[model samples]
Target: MKYAVLIGDGMADYPIEKLGGKTILQAARTPAMDYIAAHGKAGYAKTIPEGFHPGSDVANMSILGYDPAVYYSGRAPLEAASMGVTLAPDDVAFRCNLVTIEHGRIKDYSAGHISSEEAKILIETLDAELGTDELSFYPGVSYRHLMVARKNLGAETECTPPHDITGKKIDKYLPRGKDGAFFSDRIKASMIVLELHPVNLKRIEEGKNPANSIWVWGQGHAPKFTPFQELYGKTGAVISAVDLLKGIGVYAGLDVIEVEGATGYLDTNYEGKVNAAIEALKTKDLVFIHVEAPDEAGHEGSIDKKLKAVEDFDSRIVAPILKHAQTSDEPFTILILPDHPTPISVKTHTQDPIPFAIYRTDNKESDEVQTFDEDSVKKGSLGLVKASDLIGMLVKAK
Candidate 1:
């Protein structure tokens, strides 16, 4: 049997009054997703375990069948793995984001989604100036970057994610706890280094948000993961534009498929991702396709964009893959869900049970759910299942 998992990252949302009190999923036209819910099984899955933060790293790890309480070390280490930056036992990898600070307040988390080309230059410059044997910076994609500190410089430090503090004063949210002052110092140093840099000047000239500072958080050492094949008895591949998902696949021993033009934004190449998944299924038993646009839109609190993203995902990604699975000779099981809820109202990740749908070509038995949305799936036959256990159900584990 073949398997496909489609993740619309942070796609779930609370009802928006502007959208007529309907959630983005309910407002968007998602016939493909609805078809799966109508023809198969649908329910809610608690992707984030109790006492865990509602971060994508933990949620996706759970979806991929690894209990976060067991395998999750930190978000940055996963991104580091995807970037091919091996972490030593004593090294702590941090997720470094190029951010925009205005008037001592956190203005933007993503620095207006600064171009990777521009970010690379800024990252290299930071490494040149601030990097020493104990601290180093590595560029990944866009505003997302990495900093590896030797001897766990800030392993115990508590730093808030920049996205969570948008529009808030930086002083209250600055890194705290052990060695947090060290991270705060670097953040201040970055503001000085980047405020007048060529890239920031150019961006300012163009009426764009300047990446004027670096925010470091999500630090941890490397984590050990059992190969996907060893755990599930199936070879798999993962396709995503974000480094974190790719890193998870790297550690899980899944093929990390890189598609041209696949950005982790609304402009990402959806066609290329679907095509890659179809091709990967030729050799692999399962393929995981993740799209980040919905999550980005949720972060921006743009209802229209989130609606467009959800509709595009339904039409461009899900429809094509589902058509292929239906036409293929081999039986295929396809699962669709979000890693976590980046609610439009909250504008951040929330520990909510996300709705999921699973369709099988072999067995057409379905549940009461006829649509794919937060509320519609509650009546599904599958009911509520643990995110980590979904894989076992998909693989029909004995």
Candidate 2:
């Protein structure tokens, strides 16, 4: 039997009241999703580490049937692969954002929501200035970039990232010592100068997307992981709209497939992305489908949009998969779950075990579990299973 994995990034983080006291699942009248939860067995699955910060990479890795402990690495390197910039063994790379620090404070951390067009030009300008033999800045998507430089020199420094929803993504950098302090100070100074650059000022005047500043956060270097092909037997592809996940797929030795016009925002084609994933599965053994719209909407605390994203996923990807199984006699195992909880309460990911349901080809009927949530899933027979073990559950079926 073939396998199909459906993953929603950071979808389970939000609680009912967390997103203004309404769960995206509850907020949206998702009849189809609700039906699946009611008709099939459901419960909370412990897919994350206890007390650890939740991230898309970690959660997805877990759900894709990898042990987070055995196959783990810094997130920046995964994202860096998408930018086509390999990090040096002695270089430290941080997932950066072009943010506006005004009056010794972060006014807008998303570099004023710079558009791709403007972001490209700004990167060119930074290249002219910040480009160096050692330190290199390569821009990714809006407000995302890579800050790479020689490691063990001034690289073990801390950044003032809005790691938490309440904390300003740019607060202050914590230095390990005078050297780190010096490095941070210079970086901050450079960012300050970048803000005042004439190129940015011109964009502001022209009402163009102006990414006139910079901030650094989520810093790290290359890390090691068990390659996907080496562990999962190689017949899998990662299909996602976001380049970061695509990049991770690329590095993990999984086939990375791109969708036509798959933007990261609401306007993206939900059906198109799902269809792309389905088509890829015909040629591959395992398919990792990453949907970012729910997480993005949850981050903005947009309950309506988050609900829309969830329903859209059910109607688009999940439904098609289910339909394919129903219409054909082919045996396949499908699992549906979220990477982590992205509770709308604070518009950030949380380290809570998410709800999930799995359907195998052998089961006479789905389990008697009902509802999918942190609490609901705990009542199931398979209690709090690890991500790595999910493969065994499906692979052993039928």
Taking all chains together, each candidate's TM-score versus the true structure is 0.99, 0.87
Question: Per-residue lDDT for 1-398 in model 1, tens only?
Answer: 99999999999999989988999999999999999999998999999999988999999999999999899999999999999999999999999999999999988899999999999999999999999999999999999999999997898999898888888899989989999999899999999999899999999999999999999988899999999899989999999999999999999999999999988999999999999999999999999999999999998889999999999999999999999999999999999999999998888999999999999999879888889999999999889999999999999832
lDDT of 2: 0.67
Candidate lDDT (C-alpha), each: 0.94, 0.67
Total clashing pairs in model 1: 0
Provide the lowest-lDDT 10-residue window in model 1. 389-398
Q: How many residue pairs clash in each candidate?
A: 0, 17
Per-residue alpha-carbon lDDT of candidate 2 for residues 241-308, written as tens digits (9 for 90 to 100): 76668767777778887777666666666777777777876877777777877887777666777878
Which stretches in model 2 have alpha-carbon errors above 4 Å? 17-22, 153-155, 160-179, 193-210
